[model samples]
Target chain A: MSFELMLFDNFLIEKQAVSEVLLCNKITEDYSLALSEEQALELVETRSDSLKNYGRIEFGSGIIEKVILTFADTPYISQYRYAEFLNELVEIFYYFKNETLDLISDDDLIGTMKKYFDGVCQGSLDQLKFRELERMAKNVRLGLDPDYNDLYDSEKLREAEDDDE
Target chain B: MNSVKKTTKIDVDKLSGEFYFQSLLQEAYVKGVLSPKESERVQLECLKLLADCTERFTRGKSSSVRVEIAQGIMASNLYTIGIHLKSLPDVEAALFQIENESIEKLYEYGLQVLKRKIKVASYFYNRVCKTKLKTPNQAYNITIDQGFKPFFDHYEINFHAHEIPSDIDYQLIHPVTDLAGVEFVIKYLENLYYENLFCSYFDADIIDEVMTGYDPSYQNLLDNICEQVFLNALGCQLLNAPLHPLDFSLADLDALDRQLKKYSQAELQRQLKTAAQELITNLLLTNPSLKKYLIASLPKITTTIYRGLTTHSLNKVFVPRNNPNIKPIRHYNMGIKMDDAAYREMVTEFLSCRFFEDKLAIIKEQIKTLADMEDLLIAAELKAAEAAMIFDLLEDIELAVLTKRHPLHPAIDAIDYSASEVQMQQNLNAYMRALPRDRLAKILGMTTTIEVV
Candidate 1:
């Protein structure tokens, strides 16, 4: 229970997470996206830092590999900025997990993040973070559906009027 | 070679009950009983157990949880293990189990102990409810009736076993201390059940009269009723009188004052202890635990008796019982209220009036009953000083009835109040504070006895 004893680096867990991250390269390489062993370790370290920064603790194999596999085929991500994008995605995932008060499951949250990144955000991490995920987290906290957006309904109504014209 | 025996390094008596596991580890490490390598192994196993518990906590759906939650699970895990360790024969046996067993295994043992402890707690709770003292004390009644319901219903044994989830506001004669979570609760309930069992010996009506003699307003006091009842019963035994009434006359108090004044502090404690023993014997109390519980309270009772004797207040200590059913000296009828339709029309006209003089004139001409006046006091938009004028129309008994009904609760002011009601309360408080001291005291006293019809 002591913090000093409980907060060790957990080297074995880190190594396992790194191996899981590297395993995603098999599926991700189809999209010309791949993570090297060093990049995989850094992603694991990023997951650790993000978990610490967001006051979260992960047990067993983590959601990093899940994030990588889910976001790999997206047009928004490429090998050029893939590592940095994955780091931000890992960080943002933990941040919104808390922001949503854990009401959203890991798979659902990751699936929704991918849906928005490809659909609405259109490759803009800032839009995904500041606009889409913020509203989604607020919706979850207010006990509404995570995708409930009144503005979207009004805009859809406006678009229908434009079609009628 | 010198043939000298080596003494033990750790003192078992010095270990804390609340943090037994942590202190055991610390003491074992400092005393050179547990090696650093062994300690590190225990710590590593504990962390692994925490990881397992966290996975269980999230039902394996999520990979991560908040840090505070992980910390709470870790503390709960350690406390569970400590409970098992405390069940072992002695410190060395506990240390041996800690050294040899895996933390997960120790945690399993703790879980078994906690389950048994829950049954024990429930048994004591039922006993307490059965023997609960029949008194008008709100804290005692509510604590006995409703306090442990949440704990029984929602106690999270895995993640929050170290937390006490009950509302226990009633104070025990010997407060349960140095324990946490279920152990603290079990100890408290056990002590309370013993107190209730002792009080069950006397007739419930006699106990009520004794509490009334202690304080007519004893219903609001948080003081333990059992302690005073036990002291009075002991006083009855001290005077060789019948113990059923549990009352002491003035002559009884004077005789007790003279008989007990001859002893010093230690001698007085001895006398109380002997009288308490005889009390249990005469009352036919065969429960060994009850005997110990009452005897353990002798020192405190002796101090109270000694202080009372020295201060010439033996009557306060061994009070004569009074009938709690006495009628009030003055009965003030509120009179009949006007009908709702007519009162509403009057209130509308009063609110529409622009001047304070007009409001006062309207009140004087139309307000006939105290009920209509009470409602108007809340509904009207009169200022503080203006509201005092309305209060001036009521007699002392009427004010006492109102004071009893609308006691100035600071907590209620934060929610569910109208502006006019707040103003009325402030005005009434200000006016009552400005009353003549004698008249205010009389009114306050009447509040306890008055029943407004």
Candidate 2:
């Protein structure tokens, strides 16, 4: 469909479709990209330190809790861990999308996004990060020059968009 | 082939400069036969042509004089825009600059009229000046500098004081946001109002800036902008079309042509009606709370403009699809068309059944008062509009409508003007633009009276 189809995006019932596509693409599974299920679990353990490190850098700890609930259950991980990570990750995403994204630069957003992305790749986060490109494309379709560029890796974004779609 | 290339007695006369100009329109003439990078190619040619035209045409004129002349020509682009908008096929498109591709690229006027601003978040809402004007037959001065006054007896939105543009008339009105404004532009330009183009310079790169998105390669933005410009023109065309004001359906007036061109007339109209209807439904019928934003948007003067607008009488107050008493309401607002009494009576009978079966009088009275609000205010301010405003009563009228048509669940309604008063009152105009509906509401004079009888 033409890019103007973006306006109809308001009618979309779920953004999770993008996430499902990401998981199916096996993007997060790319161990070759320096991230692996083992590393994700370790990151989760370090993040959440359920046993110790309970009270330092609460935000970072939150990030840890965030990663745990998010990356919890794959063929490599368990569902219990998945729920924790999903719960924390979504709250943070809302915080970032609703709160900090605009005041901060894409550099900071990408930096933070990269941290979350580090926890889960080739799966949901990658697809979600890449979804912004479609929004830009939609803006182009709607006759708005979305004054944001120089913000992402275009080739990776294109590849990710193709994969997500 | 070699002779044709090298020695084709290139008869410059055969060109009338038009053909060479046309050839130059390609990458070869101005770029010295370089590869056609879209911007480079188009920019180099048009600019070089513009330069050549000015330099040669201003023969023996001082460079300063040439610059001055160029500036004047560039300034004329505004006139061009006014004319272009005049031809728009629909009102919405025209107001939004629908078909005027690359309009934003045109020099951003340092002096901007009031725009309707939305709040970005809980702490900030941008103030947007929403002005609605009906198209008129002849130019009328809309005295602007005399500005607006705070007349709020009811309602919570802030009323802004504006300085009317004195250039058009001692009256501050610039002519787009009022019925007379449309007429002002039309009558002023019966003959094209040619300005001295030999005086100013046009910013040649702004269109690219406006149309270029984060993905620089996105070519469709320009196309869409163009389509919008055209749609805006279509609005003008629709309003100006010879349909008797009584016969207009707004649908019969204009249609939008955008990326999808294959849709038939009915399909396109349905699509447009759907979009326009969203605004109408929200503004007139939808509960303000059930929706994301308030319909008590920019139009501190919308109803007044509606009354002034002779066309589209049905728009006086958009009765929801279910409102049975809407038929009598239209007659109540419009009464009979004095010029075409026969046709008007015929319309009343034919359309009345579709509108309502009961309580026509009260509904009619309500809509009539609603329609008269703007007219009464404007007429009152005709003598001294700037320092004094007649909006307090109208604002109350608006509040009455909102309160009566209260859409909020009785228990969980957000405070009215929470978005505007909290954010906009703080003067965070530039911020909160993107996320306009996110402002927090100020708890000033909210109805907390739970009268549990």
Candidate 3:
């Protein structure tokens, strides 16, 4: 078989493995909610296209599975928004991979995303994206102290002062 | 009618002039035109004459002068009467007689022979220079064409030299008789030119001495010098020193040579020591980033990591490969098949990842200000060993991504860059204290050392 075809087959097998992980984790308990084979393939294509803007992707990295698992537990991401959420998360992950200078581990970054999503943003994807993640990226770029909580508190204080004035 | 039988067959075209003459004398002995003793005596005299010519050529004397000398010897009747015959046994004597009778004509013929040999050597030399020799920093002003033009011009003017000829007798006359030898000579000359061009440096008689060695097949000598030149270029680049042709000028080289000549040996040594110290200081301050990058780019470090990742046998411990929660981190025997080009490409990717990752870690955790980063860098400079360890750790972490059988590692996981941070700071403090008072003052922005009484 051709090399690309072989890689595609391997990718499908990996995606199936990821699907099993999602089911076991109770993120999608039923087959109806689980990612179908076609959905998994489409997700792979979308992730690949998203990663191109950042840098070259090594084949067989299973980046699609990693991104899927990362955002699978977001509380308010409806079944309808599942694919779109995975697409955005892949884009953000790679976009920050370049922005954060690849220093932050994928696990830590997902944890941070989870923290802001559950705590401050309260399951609002747009607020977690634009306000929290964008601010953290900006602070990193500016070479500020990386304590996200400190940055968020200071920003909150500054906004409050602006309101008071 | 009785016919006389020819006893010896000689192909005149197959032999050189000297050899053809020798063959004629042998044939004469067989034909009974001359006795064996007479032929032997004449052959011995001819050998002596050729030996004299060879010695003169080896001494760098022009072949025309040697020919004229031979003619002068013949005119003075240095050979016996029987040796003066013009055919068969007389061929040697005939050749000498022509030299004596028409010295100018013989000189002209010798010059043509020399020119023809030179023409062939030059053809091979030019081809090798154009194709095989690499002058990485060969720019317009200091190009090989310009550098070799003078050598060619010198040869053109000194066309009287018959040191190089097709005859086997003349092979010892010139250093380079064969094309391969010519190639080595051209490569040696090209390297010398590059060193002079880039380093603003030249040893006055090194090239001349190498040429005078008369060994055009000295490949080891060429390789050793070429490697030194390459290293020098790399050093200069890392120092941010001006590269060849860009910063080099003819006048600068001349001036340096003049100044070097003016210094006594002891004075030159003292000056060199001071200059070296100052150069180190200037390099540290001016090009720290490049120096650190070069240190990081050392082949010793990269090759070790690359070899380990690509070839080292894995110690496998099996776990379920797909389950993320099980943390199935195991050494697998799945080696990636790649060539040198592919390996290099992957290494670049890994390095980029590492560089950014290190920067992000510092920005996210350690750095609060630009001064903080500077302090860290200065600390690194003070404790080089610790800094190298940190660098190695970071490189390993970056390389680990490619080694893993599974890609389940989170892209945003936290990595610690403070492994040596505390110790680096301690070393930096100690180094600051140990600095000379004047040097410390300068670093502290003071014009002079403050007296502590």
Where is model 2 more than 4 Å wrong at Cα? A1-25, A30-79, A105-107, A113-165, B1-86, B89-453
Q: Distance (Å) between predicted and true CA of B145, model 3?
A: 28
Alpha-carbon RMSD, each predicted model: 17.5, 31.6, 43.4
For candidate 1, the iRMS in Å is: 2.5
Instruction: Give the distance in Å from residue A2's predicted Cα in candidate 3 to where it truly belongs.
Output: 14
Q: Give the better candidate number (1 or 3) by lDDT.
A: 1
lDDT of each: 0.88, 0.29, 0.41
Estimate, for each residue in A74-144, the C-alpha lDDT of model 1 and write its tens digit.
Answer: 88777897888998999999999999998889999999999999999998999999999999999999999
The CAPRI quality class of candidate 2 comes to incorrect
Q: Could you give the DockQ of candidate 3?
A: 0.00
**The TM-score obtained by chain A of candidate 3 when compared with the true chain A:** 0.67
**TM-score of each model, paired residue for residue:** 0.75, 0.18, 0.26
Looking at candidate 2 chain B, the ten consecutive residues that score lowest on lDDT are: B191-200
Compared with the true structure, what per-residue lDDT tens digits does model 1 show for residues B146-238? Answer: 999988998888999899999999999999999998999899999999999988888988988988999999899998999989989989999
Winning model by DockQ? 1
Clashes of each: 0, 82, 12
Better structure of 1 and 2 per TM-score: 1
Docking class of 1: acceptable
